[model samples]
Target chain A: MTKTITLLLHRGPYESEYADLAVNFALKAREKGYNVNLWLYGDGVWTPHVKNEKDYPNVGEHLRKALKDGVNVKICSRCAEARDVVKDDIIEGIPMVGLFDFTDWLDNSDKVLTFMR
Target chain B: MKTLIEIFRNTPPGNACLILTKNVLSVVYGESFDDKIDEKMDITTKDFEVQLHPFPSKIAEENGIEGAPSIYINRKLKIYGVISPEEIKGLIEKAKPVKIGIIITKTPNANEDVENILAIGEEALKVGNQVELFLISDGVWVGKRGNTLTEKRLLNLINDGCKVKASRMHLKACGLNKEKLVDGVTISDEPYEDLVDLVMEQWGKVVIF
Candidate 1:
């Protein structure tokens, strides 16, 4: 049966390979015909704001790919605002959801994987 | 009897530090000393990993009780001072492994994260804690054909009821065939996303390395 998998990413982009692993897992889930959700919390709200320039592993690009695969990508508003990430600073199509959204997802999701650094 | 120094040096993380000051001091200096010492030292932080012991009188010799207000990290002397709660918190965090999901993405090499995970996971098991390890990305190599001590330990962990798994895609990515995998690994047919969810649903904490 198809499962609704929630990837709760708690690490920021570029600082480590966690964001990449999160996106990779989401993509792999999508490939297997599962519903995926990427909920960014803690330092992870910094993911969309990461600059995608040059040889650096593009966290934005991977997140964009996950979105393309129909994964619901969201960021914690409070966390983002704490890091000075205004709505305009985030990647297009990504929404700044509230902390309640994560709680709701946690209750509804069939599974949850947290990528904590 | 283990010295307070040894206890402090050997104290595991997430465990509380016990400081035994003389009861005589509590009588002479007034209970205010206990109150002051306890107030000044708060071990439990945002997460409840480490705790502060409010000077219990029992088990005095276990604490190497030589003097009043003797500070013990795992029952060892930590010298008298305004103990840095942050430092104690850090030590507690480092020494303890909570019931959690540990994902290994890096290939096993000399002194790699997998070895640490295995050691910590094994220790947790000894203490009757649960540790679920997922081998994804290059970490699938641990499940692939190999008879190294590390790989053998992976199998032993599985046989011992440890939840160890390898991603089929990752195994394939590493050019490993499923038939070649060491026994006792759950090769998920659901893909990486499901595996992530599976681990998370079961564990309150996740550590990726």
Candidate 2:
């Protein structure tokens, strides 16, 4: 069975090295045949919003590809509330859930990696 | 005691013992092997034993040891095993050649953190160095009870002769009850400042996790 790797993104995409490293790791893990899940927390909730802008390469596009390739993307509800992000504003394919749900996902995972900035 | 002797006695027949050498034979001899092994060996064998080993760095790379002054017994890292009390004693005897300091944050969230530090400290102590843990900030709450991870780890460290201290101001800020802290843990009125001074005063390398 493929191992599950949970990446906890705790910072906004642009401000921290965590997002880039996490995306890179997720893509690499997918290529390596591991099941990957990315949980966006704290400022990480802004990741899907900046996905497909004119100047931006669209992180959400990569996330979408990751999803298509079988990666699960989740954003924390508390973090979204703190950031004033509405559910409608969330990009399609990314689900927003509570911290407890995220913890359950982590507990069920084979490996958990936390990216804090 | 028999199991302890067998484990420490010059690497068993089928088991491969990887030894790391640093600062010449003196430091490695001082910290890596149990003192009982040294006491058991004849003077000629002791001299020969020290001379036979290569540099620690080379040995580490050759044996896939990740860090300096580490040992791998039975292809498993020694740190991951269920080490017995006797084995622990042997480790302490061998590890006294160096000095290591550990710092833990004393807070409600620090229970797990302190436990890990204690585990690492036990390993360090087994390697023969004096190990000291300084708890500061909210980390002083490591002494708080309710069967926390920190309490379990602290218990192990205490058994292994690791010194644990908590800061006074942090304790007051957290409103910690003095009786609730784990036994054998020293509570100081100025633990944080004392910890800082100790960090500055001693230890060649300081590891905080």
Candidate 3:
């Protein structure tokens, strides 16, 4: 049976390396056929901002790909408000929820992973 | 059944007892030791099914062991439990292994510090050791994506199968975005007290950075 893995992300883009790693892990896990859920909490919610940079790989793009591949990408509503992130400002396909939802996902999951910066 | 009876007689009815005597001094002795003495005492008194005995000084006593902060099972001291000389070895081997808890806090020197801690964790993993790593306080900053050495090292460690955790409350306090963190990191809703209890229960050794 496939295992459900929950990833609690707590970092932001251009601040440290966590965003990149989270994307990579999601991609790899999807490739391996595991059910992966990526939860954006705290500062990690800002990761989906569409970057205008020329050289860097887009975090939002990575998330979109994961979503296309069946990964559940979510952001914390409380975190977004605390960080001044508006609903419309979020990337496509990702929903803003609360800690309770994250907890529920975790309780129903087989494994939980954390990525912090 | 005979072996079980012998074990029951030698062991004090619970899990093996572990003594971590690390660099702690009795004041009167004017000396320091590097083991988990209090932890050992607690385990000895607890109502668990199996026992884990920790002997931190069997090395300095030169009984021919090489690591400090080491564990001695059945009078045999080893660095990472590598030596045994008798049939009792099998019994000692049957004892439950210790869990290790590692916490990395973000600081002004967050980048380099997380990298170093991850390197240490990788080494532990190489030895077939399992550990739980928690990122709390400013340490949550290490979870940020892009332009940091610590981030890269942390991702590598996660890929290599390290259990990574972070404090959810701390992240909110710092206004850090959970989406920006690396994949495979779990946010802990449990309080710091719970974290401490869990670590104490699982790990024989707890290292903080």
Which predicted model would earn the best TM-score?
1
lDDT of 3 at B141: 71
Candidate 2 stretches greater than 4 Å from native = B1-209
Error at B170, model 3, angstroms: 28
Off by over 4 Å in 3: A51-53, B1-209
Best by DockQ: 1
TM-score of each: 0.49, 0.41, 0.45
Q: Give the TM-score (vs. native) of candidate 3.
A: 0.45
Question: What are the clashing pairs of model 1?
Answer: B4-B76, B4-B77, B13-B95, B21-B69, B22-B68
- Worst 10-residue stretch by lDDT in candidate 2 chain B? B1-10
- For model 3 the interface RMSD, in Å, equals 11.5
DockQ of each: 0.24, 0.02, 0.02
lDDT string for model 1 (A20-113, tens) is 8888878877876778889999999888886456585687888877888899999898988888888888778888979888888888887677
Clashes of each: 5, 15, 62
As for model 3, its CA RMSD to the true structure in angstroms is 15.9
What is candidate 2's lDDT per residue for B56-170, written digit by digit as tens? 4454455554432233432223432234435544553543344567666435462465556667788777654568776665566777765555677777777777777776766
Ranking by TM-score: 1, 3, 2
Off by over 4 Å in 1: A51-56, B1-102, B105-133, B137-152, B158-209
